[model samples]
Target: MSTAFCFGIRFPMFICMSSFAIIPTSIVVERAIALWKRNKYEHYGCRLGFAISIICIVVSLIMSAWSMGKMNLSDLTVYCSATTNETADRITIICFTYCGIDVITLSGMAWLRTSNVAAMKGKYSDLRSSYQLRENASVIRVLLPLVVFDGLSHLVFSLGGGVFLLFRVHFSYVAYRTI
Candidate 1:
């Protein structure tokens, strides 16, 4: 029961970080590309941010899928009731894989932040340096928040998933010991 509860709370975080995060990243990247082509230097920061966000989103999704598939819910149920030891062990292995996925997701998001910062300093010779601020205003205000939100969400989800897994393992261990 506790294991199920933990999963219920944490699973949504995984979904939000993996799937929902992609939307804003895509929108920002598309918008940024348009601005860059138009010689909009000011908005370059936003475009750069979007590009970073896209990279993060892609990595996060890939990691999430890998982790979730390895979890194999059917095997996991064994922890709560009688089942083949082989099946339960398989689920445990899957849980370990999910842990790796969380790490990959976090690392990718960190990279996105670093790359976005670099983009801020990137050169775009086609546009006058003077227009940097002017072009950047809209991008900064809109895309920055979106990127931050996605990144934060991913981090939160990763942590939450870990906590849920830990709790599940603890309870399962106690259950097995008592029985």
Candidate 2:
């Protein structure tokens, strides 16, 4: 029952965070392909950063699943309940690590996007005074917000995950004591 409730909370969060991670990845890939067609090798770093972010997102999801499994195991649950402080500390540490990785990846993507925007602005300045600059400006605007939102979401997730892990540790401890 406790396991079920733990999963109930994590499942929705996983879906939400995954969606946030995946959509920007798609945009990054699309823009990279477009820039590549234009012979802009400059955006390669941004592409690479987004690719890494995608990988980190996948790995984090896997870790979350594994942690859920550990929670479901009867022996581990019992142990966790008995050693609440220890369990909480360990869980908090793991969650903090995961969240830190997520934040770093998101920040990388954001920095890459910011650089891309700066480059585009410089490259398209003369073109900017023309109608063609519309597309260029639009891309800059789009990438800017995506990057910002992605980073912010990662930060929020990190904080939420840390808090949730702490709560789980306490809950496990209480359950163990009562049962």
Candidate 3:
């Protein structure tokens, strides 16, 4: 395939996949902050979350564009697999970095929750505060599993890419060539 054709197919896919990969980390951090600043978050959480999502999208766009630009079209054979080993390595590093950030955000959220619970046990105990805590807990309960799943998927993908790189295993579209 021509380089432009390959890029046309890969560019949007990269942007979408990268955006999906990044938005989760943004959400985790936003939730952590919301948990930390309870009352203030309640007032502006939606706007804050939207802003964070936009930032994630913009970051994803930039990263995808840069990576796509770095892709080696000369490597293209019968199919649209044009990325060089260096580009693959960079993508794997990015995936691992995102996974690390997710882990750290989860840890921070846990710490914040514990501190909030301890504080609630003291003089600040109130029905509204308790209700907000429960609501936050419920939201976390729902989001936690999804985030964990996303992280694990990323980890597996990164490991697979690492293994492929280690072995120098490059798969081509032989079936397409035959066709």
Candidate 4:
């Protein structure tokens, strides 16, 4: 296929995929921040969340542009394949970055939940504070599994890619090779 055709297809695909991966994490982080700063977040949460989403989109666009620039389009053959070492490196970096962010956010949420529970023990009225704590706990309980799953999936994929790259094994060959 022509280089233009390949670029046209791949560039948008990259942007969409990157945005999909990043936007959720950004929203989850925003929620965690809201949990931490309830007062300010209550007033400005919508704008703040919008800003974070915009930042994520912009970052993904920049990354996609940089990655597309690094591609050796001149070498296109029968099909457009982003199997270069640079592509592999970029994927690994992106996956690991996602994993790292997930870990930090998860830890922060856990800490916030614990500290708030401890602080509210005797300092505040059990009725109101307990209800708030229960709400926070429920949010945490829902978020914890989703974040852990996302992080673990990214971690596993990145590690697998790293191992394959280290061993100089191509994924297509491994996955599609004849027995």
lDDT of each: 0.49, 0.53, 0.65, 0.62
Kindly indicate the candidate among 1 and 4 with the higher TM-score: 4
Q: Please give, for residues 58-130, the per-residue lDDT of candidate 4 as tens digits.
A: 9888877765676666655455644454465665465455556556655665676676566546454545445
* Model 3 deviation from native, Cα RMSD in Å: 4.1
Worst 10 residues of 4 by lDDT: 170-179
lDDT head-to-head 1 vs 4, winner: 4
Worst lDDT 10-window in candidate 3: 170-179
TM value for model 1? 0.39
In the range 66-102, model 1's lDDT, one tens digit per residue, is: 4444343433442443112333443344444444454
Model 3 lDDT vs. the true structure?
0.65
Q: Clashing pairs in model 2?
A: none
- Cα RMSD for predicted model 4: 4.1
Candidate 3's TM-score reads 0.75
Best by lDDT: 3
Candidate rank order under TM-score: 3, 4, 2, 1
Model 4 stretches with alpha carbons more than 4 Å out = 119-135, 169-179
Task: Using lDDT, rank the candidates from best to worst.
Answer: 3, 4, 2, 1
Better of 1 and 3 by TM-score: 3
Runs in model 2 deviating more than 4 A are 2-15, 18-61, 73-94, 121-137, 160-179
